[model samples]
Target: MKRNILAFMAVMLMLCMSAQTSQAQLKRFSIGPYVEAGFPTGDFSTTHNPGFGVGLGADVKLIAGLTAVGSVGFDYFKGKTIDNGNTKIASAKVIPVRLGLRYQLISILYVKVEGGTANFTGDYNNGTGALVAPGLGIRLLGLDVEGKYEAWFKDGTHGFFGLKAGYNF
Candidate 1:
């Protein structure tokens, strides 16, 4: 937890410096809501199954084609069975704080790389942690679609892939 906070603060400091450097070229801010679905890609011996998440987020254009995004989300998962006839059934709700940089390829298409923490709670795990993720996004007809891969590095490292859809304003 302490380490995560320190890392977040460090990233924020860097963002602040970047913001200052690009203040003159900053664009406007935009807010939107999003829904995401995540799939587990490894063994789930003692954890919940694949999950779905939904939340709200916003983006602020800091440079010519760069944007900073932050979001708060809740994820729910159903537990699964493991070896040795042991069934682990549980549910979890997580809060994911994300910051990303978006590079616009055109008027409606962009690519993004994001990283942040996922604070989890509920019937499974009782701890908070951070994960680094990178993703790509595209906009079409007022809707945005994205796919991201997240790697969590704490006690043990694990990875997951997520697909999200939303509307951008």
Candidate 2:
């Protein structure tokens, strides 16, 4: 997990340097900090368990209607038991570093392909691995809404749908 985080940071630094060179010609480059509350929905042992998460990201408009996004986020899942009562399965802290290509479908709507590595911590028996998530987004009234299905090759697959309300600045 530590190594993955380091790698992600390194990549982010490189991207930032590149962006700096092109900043003069870019239309807009903005950063937004967001918080998200959602649950993990999957067929794994733990389902319908609620969790809260937060993230910070930057969006760099590379073209007129296209942008390059990089984000790092974390989530904590209070696991569930097989029976009715709740059990302490495990709490996961996920750091997802994604590089996405965004296309403005309309004036206030956009879709993105989110592919990144999810460095996880906690007692998730399936093991920690990377994930490739494809998602969509919409920008309206200074708020951005996004939903994506994440697939972990080893740490179990889950769908994460999030609604983020943040100012793009």
Candidate 3:
């Protein structure tokens, strides 16, 4: 897990350096906090309710309409069942770290693709998974409203659809 995180950071650093050298100047940079909700999908939907989370995100403009983006967040979901017949399963928690690139389609609309790792903790669930999410958003008056689908691959595939709202600072 540590090695994976370190590798991710190294790649991000390299990208940043290369962008700085290649671009004449960055268009913009922003950082902000966001609140998000996740609706479990596939088999995961049967066992868990909706999840809520909070995160901090940053964007570095590499060119006119392209940006490098990254975020770290924590999410929690309540279980629908009392037990899985063996152990008591009450809730689940996830910590996700992600990096991606975003392209602005127009002035207010953008699309993004991100991949990273997520740490899961819950009853009978403890491990790390590779995660991928593709999303679209609209930026209005410094506020962002976005939606995406996220899939985590570990022992099996767990997926969710997420909505996020935030302000850029």
Candidate closest to the true structure, highest lDDT: 3
Q: What is the TM-score of each candidate against the true structure?
A: 0.75, 0.77, 0.81
How many times do residue backbones clash in model 1? 0
TM-score-best of 1 and 3: 3
Instruction: Output the lDDT of residue 7, model 1.
Output: 66
lDDT of 3 by residue, 1-169 (tens): 6675566567656755665577537435566789999999987787788999898777788778888888877888887764555544567788788989999999999999999988887753688888999999998866999999988888787789999999866
The positional error of residue 87 in candidate 1, measured at the CA in angstroms, is: 2.8
Model 1: lDDT of residue 125:
61
| lDDT of the candidates, in the order given | 0.69, 0.67, 0.82
Question: What's the C-alpha lDDT at position 134 in model 1?
Answer: 82
* lDDT-better candidate, 1 vs 2: 1
Give lDDT tens digits, candidate 1, residues 29-76: 545678888887665324657788887666667678777776656666
Best by TM-score: 3
Comparing 1 with 2 on TM-score, the higher-scoring candidate is 2
Runs in model 1 lying further than 4 Å from the true structure: 1-27, 44-47
